[model samples]
Structure formats: structure tokens, C-alpha cells
Target chain A: MLNVKDVKKDFPVLKNRDVVYLDNAATTLTPDSVIQSLKNYYQNLGTSVHRGIYQLANETTEKYERARKKVADFVGSDSPREIVFTKNCTEGINIIAYSLHHWPEMEGKILVTEMDHHSNILPWRFMANGSEKFQLEYVDVTKEGRLDLEDYKSKLSPDTVAVGVPGISNVVGTVNPIKEMTDLAHERDALVVMDGAQWLPHRKFDISEYKVDFLTFSAHKMLGPTGLGVLYGKEDLLCRMPPPFGGGEMVLKVDRRKVKWNDPPQKFEPGTPPIAQIIAFGASVDYLNELGISEVNEHVDRLAQRAVNKLSEIPYVDIYGPKEGESRGGLVSFNVEGVHPHDLATALDSLDNIAIRAGLHCAQPLHEVMELNSSARASFYVYNAPEDVDRFIDAIKEAKKILGGADER
Target chain B: MKDKPEIYNQDVVHHYQNPHNKGKLSDPDFSVTEENPKCGDRVTLQIKLDGAEISEVKFHGHGCVLSIGAASILTQMIQGLNVREALELTFDDLVENMGNPAKMRKDCASLSLNALKKALSGW
Candidate 1:
């Protein structure tokens, strides 16, 4: 069992007000350890890596590479050379889509799920509209808001070049069966890309266990600093794919007539990276390791289940995602009848200073399937507690009285 | 607005629920639809011109309270006003009629007015 009190103390923002932050699906609060590591890097050694041979540069390079190794070990990768740093999860996915167009013999079909965020959808849309002319297909989501395995099985074929799906739905918090999906895709020789942005912070993940070709996630969503993301690929796949961007540090040798590319990880990283944030991200991994990802997952799941039960007690409120007692991540997306999500969010904020996300949650297509313009989402993390869920439920009742006056509860 | 929820005052909520002139105008002289893609707030404003006056004005769409309330308030404000007078109305006029919205909701408050302006400009 994890202690919510200890985790809350690590985040200074939690003390700023009587506010209940239920927007962890968007971005998590950074802990003091991550913040202190950031300060230590900039205050003590403010220098670039892989450029200088001096003690400072060598130390910085070692720390940076050590962070990469930490991330690799955290994800259970065979080698640290497989992890490439990027701006955010969006950039990591874009790199794969960018390189896919140039694969000479690869087919043009790409299968994606409707439950994916826009970042996962748009990159492939660009490929289809651009010169690559890739045929993009969507796997239908079941009525329960989970991916339809039947639709996915039919969609997977020899022509399908890649399959991109989120490990967990950001809106409904449905934890998809990624390993089975990956195995099915591999049977047809199709590569699987898992959007681990919402998965890494909530559960235990091992890259080799899932056998995914590419995994992308953002640090900010996992209690780390922003402007840092990870793209972990199988060594053979990374070596086979072309570099997405070319600039300093990515090339071994440059010539007017010929150019020699660097190794897999370095070949993808162009220009100076976010060195400070990466080091802080290492601290965040350490924080998670100390608490244990399985315990964190259990804590959040307990909170989410309690929230779902309390919110479902209100007759006027409609919750989306998994059924009661089903396994889901630490989030609940819902809406009150006859009340717009924005109005409900504003009402909740005013009543109890509760913070929640009230929008499409970037899965507009999923909302379209749900037949709603928008919905409000309340997501929990390590720091959130059952008391917070109680407050959220009370605030929802207040919103119902204020906004959904015409609806009966 | 910071300490309290001034955005959805009683007046705004009342106007949102019991909006005036809230259906399609029959045989409308002009019509326009606008959607704020951010939150999927959409509104369509229709007008029936009686000579130089806007004899009838109605709106049909879905949006948040601010946009819907502003549309209702705008329709009531310009129902009997002349076409020239309605065209001269600014976004400030809309804000004055409805309470000032938050910085993020400025677009929601002005969406109906912008659509109305576009409808008249295209005329």
C-alpha cells in the first residue's frame, strides 16, 4: 500500500490551495525530487553534452547517457541504445510516421484505433495525404469504449504496415490488451506502436514482455518535467528505419558526396536535446521505482473505483469507460444530463475549487462515437485520495443542482 | 470572476435556458453557421429582413452556456432593430449585454456575434 500523504508532500502545488486536481490524464504534478534534480543539473553543471572532452562535459554526457540507461532499464529494454529522446510523445510518433514513407518495400496500409489521441491520428493522416499515400484504417471501438478485438483482427492483414494504439485510453481509462494486440500484429509482420503516455505512470510496463516495435510516452504526464519524451524501438527496427531529422550530433561523418549516419539512438536525436529535463526525468523514474509502479497502479485503481461508484450513485450523471469492477486506469470520463461539460466544470470549480478537464480530451472521434460534443473527465494519480473522490462527487451534485436543474436526480 | 463564478450569473443561465427567438426563422432572408472547433460549440443565426429592419431573428445550434446565452441575448437585442443598426453592433455590445467572460471564454462569448456579423457582411 502506498501512502498518499507522503506523495502529496513531495508536490508543492498540492499545498497551494484547497483545490482537488483531477486532471492527471492531462499532466501530472512534478515532485520535489524531480525539481531538485533539475536545479542541481543547471546550477552545478550548465553545459552541453557529447561536444567537449573536459570534465564537466564528460560528466554531463555520462549523466545524460545514464538517464537513457535508467529509462531503458525501467522499460525492460535489452539495451540503452534503443531509447531515443525527443520533445514529447507527439514528436516520437511523428518520427516513426516520417520514416515509414521512405521504406521502399513496405505496404501502405496503417491500422489505428478511434480511441487514440489526435497526435497518433494526425501523423498518419499526414502520411496518407502527403506523398506516401498510405491507406489509413480505424479499428472500431466497442460500445463499452474499449477497442473491438474483432474489428482489429479483421483489419490486420499482410498489407498493414503499422498498428498504433494507446496502452490505456486517456478519456475512459480503459487499459487495452497491448501484448495480445502486439502478438497478433507481429503474426502478420506488421509493426506495433504503443502510445504509452498514459500507461507509463499508472502501471508496470516491460518492453520485451509486450514485444512492441515502438513505444512513445511523455515525461510530463509521468511526474517529470516537460519538453522531454521517449521513443523506444527494437534495435533491428531502429537500424532499419531512416532518421527523421538530420542536424548536429546525428551524423558520424559529413561530406559533399557522401554522409555516414551515426548509430540507432544517436541517429534519431538531432541538435542539442533537453539535457536538464532528461536528468530530472531520471529522478522521476527513481521516484516511481521507490514507490513501485504496481503499488502506484493499485492505489490509483482503488481511487478510480471509488470515484466511479460514488459518481454512479447520482441518477443524473453518466459515466463512460469500463463497467463497475472492471480493470481500468485511474480516470473517469463522464457528463451530467442536460448540462454542458464546460458549464459543469465551471460550476464544480466555483463550488469547491475542484479542477477537472472539460473538453473533447483530444479524442474527438471517440466523443463522436459516444454522441456527445464534449464531456468532463476527472483523473486520479498517486497523490489523489478517496477523500478527493468524495469531494468530486459532492461537487458533481452541486453542479447538477446548479446547471442540470431541468433533469431529475 | 477569479474568486467566484461570475461567468454564469443567474441572468446568463436564465437566458441560456429560456432563450428568446431560439428556432429557425421561416423564409429567412439570410443565414450563417459558425462553429468553434475547440470545444465544438456551434451556432447558426437566421434573420428575416422586413425592408430595412430585421423583423425576425432566431438561432439554431448547440454550444456552451456563454455562447448560447450570448446568442439568445443578441437575438433579443436585434430583433426589431434595423439591418443597418444591427450591422453596426460590435463585440463590446455583446459583452455589455452579457457578463464579461473569462479570458479563455472570450471566443465563446463572441462566436454568435461573429457569425451574425459574417451573415450581414455576406449579404
Candidate 2:
């Protein structure tokens, strides 16, 4: 069992603040090891990577690339060459969409689900926009906020070129059957792109097991530094696909008329990369490895289930996502009757300084389909405990009383 | 403003539950809808002018306690006031009429005023 008290000690924010932070779905708290690694990089080795000839530059480059290998190993990829660093998860998805938009063979429809964040949706929308050869389609989401597999099977035609699905809904907390979906999409000869932003933090994901053509996630959401994201693509697929953006270090030979791209990972990562963030991410991976992803996931699931059970008992509270005891991510999205999400969020804050996300959570299409104006979400992390959940439940009742929840029966 | 649960303030709850001048004006002289992109709350403010003054003013659409309550309170305040004077009524002025929570989320509190300004910017 993962000890919450020990994990909480690693996070300075938890020790410093008396606030209950339940917004882990948005971003996880940075731990001391990751922060120390960042400070070490800036304090000692302040040189750029993949360029300079001196020992300091070469040493920094070694550390930077070693971080990539650690991340690759953490995700169970045999080769670090498959991992490409980008600005964030959004940029990684955009890179794939950009590369596919330029591919001559990419045609017909680009499919995405209603649960996808704007990061996954807008890139495809921008790709399909004003293009005759390409079209955008949305897989239906059931009333329970679950992905409609029947709708997905119906839409997975031969003409479907790609499917961008979330491994877990950021808002609804629905843990998707990504392996099954990937297997099905592969049968149709369609490329599957999984948004792993929510999955990576709470679960163990082996690329070979899922066999997704592309997986994109942010390191910041997994106790790593911000401004760094990873794009894991199949070796052959990365080799075949073209890099959309071009700059320094991405190309080996720049001809007078044409340029020869370097390789898969480097070609995708143009210009100077986020050196400090990448180095710190390696420490984050080490941190997770020490805790063990399975134990962390199980601990989170227990707390989330506890939250679901307690919330279900409240007559005025409505919860979204997978039902109690069903598989879900580390968050719970809910709404208080007759109280707007913003009002409820504010009331919670005023009641006990409980920090929760209160808005669309960047899945506006999902909210629109669900017929909700906005919703409040309480997300959990490694540091969050059962007591935190109880405090949250108590705060909800108090907040409801002041917010005039429902019509008082 | 931060310490108190402003949305549940007796005045805000009363205004939100029983909004004043919430219906549409027929053959309205000016009508505009403004949205708080931050939280996705919307407010549509409609007005009928008699000479230089706002003869009738009403607000409609979906929003939270601050936005809806502020719109309800502001419409009642704007009645019979000169159109230019209504435009002069700043967010702070509206908060003074209502409560101080409006100052915290000024965008939501000023949504109705933003619509009114958009509808009358041509003048």
C-alpha cells in the first residue's frame, strides 16, 4: 500500500499550504525531487544540448537524452528514439495532426469523440476545415458520459483515416477501453491516437500492450515540470510521417533547394528543447517508479470510489462519469442542484479553502452534449487521502446549505 | 469579499431567485448579448429608449449567481436613467448597488453592462 503521509512529505505545496487541493486532473503538485533536479540543472550545467563541443555541453546533452530514455523506459518503450519532446500535450497532438494533414495518403475522415479536450479536437478541426479530402466526425457519448462503442464501430469505416480518443476523459473520468479500441481501429486499418494526459498520472500504460499508433501526454500532470510533453509513436510510423515544423537540429543536411531530415525523435523535436523541464521529468519518473504505478492507481481508485459512494447519498448532488465500483480515472465530476458550478466552487473555497476546478474543464463539447452549462470537478492525487474526501463531503453539505441547493424538498 | 460566501449573500440569492425585469422588450430599440468566456456565462440585455433615457430595460440568458443577480439588480437601477448615464455606471458602481463580491469576478459582474455598452456603442 502506498502511504499518503509519506507521499505528502515529498510535495512542498502540501506541507506549506493548509488548503485541500483536488485539482490534480488539471495538474499535479510538483515534488521536491523534481524541483531539486530542476535547480541542479540551472545551477550547475547552464549550457545547451545537441550542439556545443566542450565537456560541459556534452555532459548536459548526456543528461538530457538520458532523461528521454528514463521516460521511454517508464512507459515500457524499448527505444528512447520513439519519444519526442514538445511544448505540452496540446502541442504534441497538434504535431501529429499537422504531419497527417500534410501526408498525401491522409484522406477521408478524422474521427474524435465528444469527450476529447480542445487540444485533441481543434487540431483535427483545423485540419479538416476547408479541405475537400478530409472531414471531421465525432463518436457519440452515451448519457452516462461513456463513449458509445456501438457508435464507434459504426463510424469506423474503411474511409476513416485516424481516430483520436482519450485514454480517460478529463471531465467525466471515464477510463476508456483503449486496447480494445486500438485493436478494432487496427482491423479497419485506421491509425489510433490516444491522449494519455489523464491516463499516465494514474495508471500503468505499456505502449506495446495498447499498440496505439500515437500517444501524447504532459509531464506536468504527473508530478513533473510544466512546458514539457512527450509524444510516443511507433518506430515505423514515426519514420514514415513527416515533421510539420522545421528548424535547428531537426535536419542533418540542408541542401540549397531541399533538406534531409535527421531522424524520428530529433526530426520531431526542432530547435533547442526544454532542457531543465526534461531533466526534472526524469526525476519524476523515478519518483513514480519508487511508489509503483499500480499501488498509486489502487490508492486513488479507493478514494475516488469512496467519494462516489458518499456523493451518491447526497440527494442534491449529481455525479458524472463511470458508476460506483466501475473503473474510472482519479477524479469525480459533479454538480450541486440549483447552484451553478461557479457558485458551488466559490462556496467550497469559502467554506474550507478547498481548491477544485469549476468550469468546462476544456471539454466544452462534452458539457454541451450532456446539456450542462458547467460543472465542478474534484480530482484526486497521490497525496490526497480519505480524510480529504471526508472534509470535501462535509464542505459540500455546508456549501449547499448556503448556496440554497435545490428547492429544499 | 473573499472571506464571505458572496454568492449566497442574502441579496444575491434573492435577486437570482426572483430576477426583476427578466423578460424581453417588444420592438426593442437596442439589444445585445455578452458572454463571460472565462466561465461560459451569458447575459443578453435589451432596452427601449424614450428620447435620451432608458424607458424600459430587461435582461435574459444563463449565468451564475453574480452575473444573473447583478443583471437583475442593474436593470432595476438603469430604469428611467439617461442612456449615457447608464453607460457611465461602471462595474464598481454596480457593485456598490449590489454587493462587493462583484469586484472579485468583475467579468461576470460586468456582463450586463458590457452588453448594454455594445448595444449603445454606435450612439
Candidate 3:
């Protein structure tokens, strides 16, 4: 298990006396190492990469490539050639959507899950609207928030091009069986893209073991700076797919009449990149590696289980997602009877300075399927502790008193 | 103004705990549903009219404290007003009624006010 005290010290935000942050699913707190790396980049080695021949540019280029390799190793990709840096997870998914225009035959029938984040759902839906050959089929999820594999099996057809799903759900904290899903999709000759935005920071993942065609995640959600994302596709596939955006650094040569694009990863990464943020992201990954993902995952699982057990004891609290804590990460989405999620969130905030997310969490289809308009979610990261969970539970008890009793139900 | 606790301000928790005139009015003169998908704040308003005057108003549904409180206070505020006057009510009026608007509270307060206006349209 990770030394929770040491892990907490890495994040400076924990020093704030009045803030109990339980919103890791929205974004994680950056560690000092990552923050310092960003500062060092700006202070000393600040220059554009790939385009310059000067000493500073060469140093910047080497650091940028090293960062890419670090990300490649972190995700277990075969080579750094497959790693394409984008602005964020949303943009990464959009690249896949834009590539769908090149494959018209498979556009009409794309398969996605109801539990997907809006970033995963909307891009394909937009493509469907723009092309007659494009349409979307959705797989149902179980009441406990696990993917209904039987439903997914039925939804996969010969016409399906790809199945976009999440590695971990932002709302429910359900860790999907992505390897099985990807294997099933590959058997049907369809590609699979895993949204790892909620998964990467909390646990260690190997992309090669899953053999997914593409993987996407954001740095901000992983304790790095915002506006940076990593998109990993197999080198062969990346070479076949054209760049979605075009500008400097992404082209080999350009004339008024024609332009030749760079290789797989560089072709996709255009414009001046978020250099400091990417370097900082590498630092965050290093920090996570040092802590060890196995320890981090176990710590998070223990915290979630403890929270579930404690929250379940509260008279009318309705915790959603898998009942087994082992099947979930360090997040719990719940609602107290007779109290709306927003009211519960506000009450908790007022009572204990506890911060939690209260909303549909951009998973509208999932909420609609579950017959819930919204929910209150408390998500955890390495920096969170058992005391945080205790405070959260106590706040919920106080909220119950503030919003009246369970008798209203 | 009554030395209200910061957490128990007339604007903060009152409408959520004891909402005013909540529920549907069958065969009401005006009705509408307002929603803010971002925060999952939803409200359904039903108003009764006697000629141009709103005789009664009620709201029902689920939302944050700010939203529920605003809806409750709105029913109390608009009960005796004319349909035109209620229609003229902006989100600012609702925020003002709830004391002062915080940066984030404005959206929740406005959602109920917008629902009220939409409900008043056909009346």
C-alpha cells in the first residue's frame, strides 16, 4: 500500500486548511514535482521544438521527445511513434471522428456505450449527423453500472467500425473490462478506442495487454496541467489515418499547391504544443511511477470500500454503482433520500467544507437509463485519506439533518 | 436582515427545506418546465390566472438548494402579481429576493425565474 501521508505531501493543495477536495474525477491536484518541472521548463529551456536548429531548440526537441517516450512507457505502448499529443481528451476523440470521414462504408453503424462520457458520445453523434453513412448504436449497462456485455455483443454488427468506451467511468467509477471488450471488437474486425481519462491516474494500465486500437486520456485528470492529452494508436494505423488538423510542426514540406505531412505522431500534433504542460505531465507520470500504481490502486480501493461501508450505514443514503468495492475505484456516486443532489452537495459544503460533484457528470444517457436526473459524487485520488472519507460521511449526516429526515421519502 | 446564519440565509436553505406552493395545479392557466442540464437543476411551474392577475403559483421537481429555494420564494413573490408583471420578472429579481446573488447562485436562481416566465406566456 502507498504511504498515504507521503502521497498527500506531494500535493500542495492538501495544505489548505478548509478545503476537503473530493472532486478528483473532475480533475486531480498536481504534485510539487510536476509543478516544479513546469516552472523549470519556462525558466530555463523554453523554446520551440522540431522546427529549430539552434542549441535551445535542439534541447527543447530532445526534452519533448523524451516526454513522449515517457508517456509511451507509462501506457505500455510498443514505441513512442504511436503517442500523439493533443489539446485534451475531447480533441483526441475528435481526431478519431474526423478520421471516420475517410472510411465512409463503416460510418453508418458505430457502436458506443450509454455510460460513455460526453466527449466520447458527441463526436460520433456529430459525425453521424454530417454523413448519411454514419449512425450510432448503444450498448446498455447493468443497474450496478457495469457494462452489459451481452448487450454489447448484440449491438456489434459487421458494419460497425469502432466501439468507443471508457476504461473507468467518471460518474460511477466502474472499471470496465476493456481488454475483453477490445478483444471482442477486434474479432469482429472493428477498432476500439478506450477513454482513459478517469483510469490512468488511479491505476496502472498496459495498452499492449488490452490491444486496443486507440487510447485517449487527459493530463489534468492525472495530476498534471490542463490543456494536454495523449492519444495512442498503433503505429501502422496512425500512418494510415490522416491528420485532423494542419499547421506548422506537423508538415514535412508545404508549397502553395501541395504539402507533405510528417510521420504518424508528428503529423497529428500541429501548431506550437503546450511544451511546459507536456513536460510537467511527464513529471507527474514519474511521480506516479515512483509511488507504484499497484500501491495506489490498492489504497484507492480501500478508501472506496471504507466509504461505501460507512455511507451504507447512513439510514437513507443510496449509493450507486457496483456493490463490491473491488469492482470500483475510489469514487462513489450517491443520493440521500428526500434530498436532491445539489442540496446535499451544498449542505455538505456548508457543514464541513467538503467538495463533491453534483450533476449528471456529462453522462446524460447513463443518468436517463438509471432514471436519475442527477447524483452527488465523491471521487478520490492518492492524496485523499480515510479522514477525508470520515469527514465526508459526517457531512452527509449533517446534511440529512439540514434537509429534513428520511421520513419525506 | 434577521441576522441569518450564512448557511441558513433566506436565500441558501429555506426553499429547499420548506418550499412554498409546490405541486402541479390541474387545469392551470400557465405551465412550463425549466432545466439546466449542466447542474441537473430542473423545475416545473404551474400558475393559475383570474383574467390578467395570477391567482396562484406553484413549483415542483428536484434541484439544488439554490434552485429549490428560488422556486419556493418565487411562488411566494408572484402569487398576487399580474401575469404581465410576473412575465416581466427577470433572474435578477429572483436573486434580489434571495438576498444577493453570488457568482454561481445566479444560474440556479435564474432557471426558476425563466420557468415562471415561460409558464406565464399563454396566460
The residue ranges of model 2 lying beyond 4 angstroms of the native Cα positions read A406-409, B1-9, B102-104
Q: Write the per-residue lDDT of candidate 3 for residues B12-121, one digit (tens) a residue.
A: 56566777898888888777899998877789988888888888788898776778888898889898898788878877677778875345556777787888867767
lDDT of 2 by residue, A288-374 (tens): 999999998999999999999999999988999898899999999999888888888877777887888888888889988998888
Best by DockQ: 2
Clashes of 2: 0
TM-score, prediction 1: 0.96
Highest lDDT among the candidates is held by which one?
2
**Model 3, residue pairs in steric clash:** A107-A134, A108-A133, A108-A135
Clashes of 1: 0
lDDT of 1 by residue, A1-409 (tens): 9999988999989887677999998999999999999999989988999999899999999899999999999999969999999999999999998888667777569999999999899998898885554899999997679899999999898889999999999988999999999999999999999999999988999986899999999999999999989999999888888887989999999999888889989999989999999989999999999999999999999999998898888888899989789999889999888888888877778788788998888889898887878888999999998889998898777677667555431
Regions of candidate 1 where Cα sits further than 4 Å from its true position:
A130-133, A407-409, B1-7, B50-53, B81-88
Across A1-409, the per-residue lDDT of candidate 3 in tens digits comes to: 7777888787787875567889888988889999899999999998988888899989988888898999999999869999999999989999987886564445557888989999999999888885677788888988778899999998888777899999988888888999899988888899998998988887888986888898999999888899899899889888878778888778889999998989989889888999989888889888888888888888888888988999888879898887854578679999888777876776677777788999889999999888888899999888888999999988787767666644642
Q: Arrange candidates by lDDT, highest first: which order?
A: 2, 1, 3
TM-score, model 2, chain B versus true chain B: 0.89
Worst 10 residues of 1 chain A by lDDT: A400-409
Between prediction 2 and prediction 3, which has the larger DockQ?
2
In order of DockQ, best first, we have: 2, 3, 1
Cα lDDT of all candidates, in order? 0.88, 0.90, 0.84
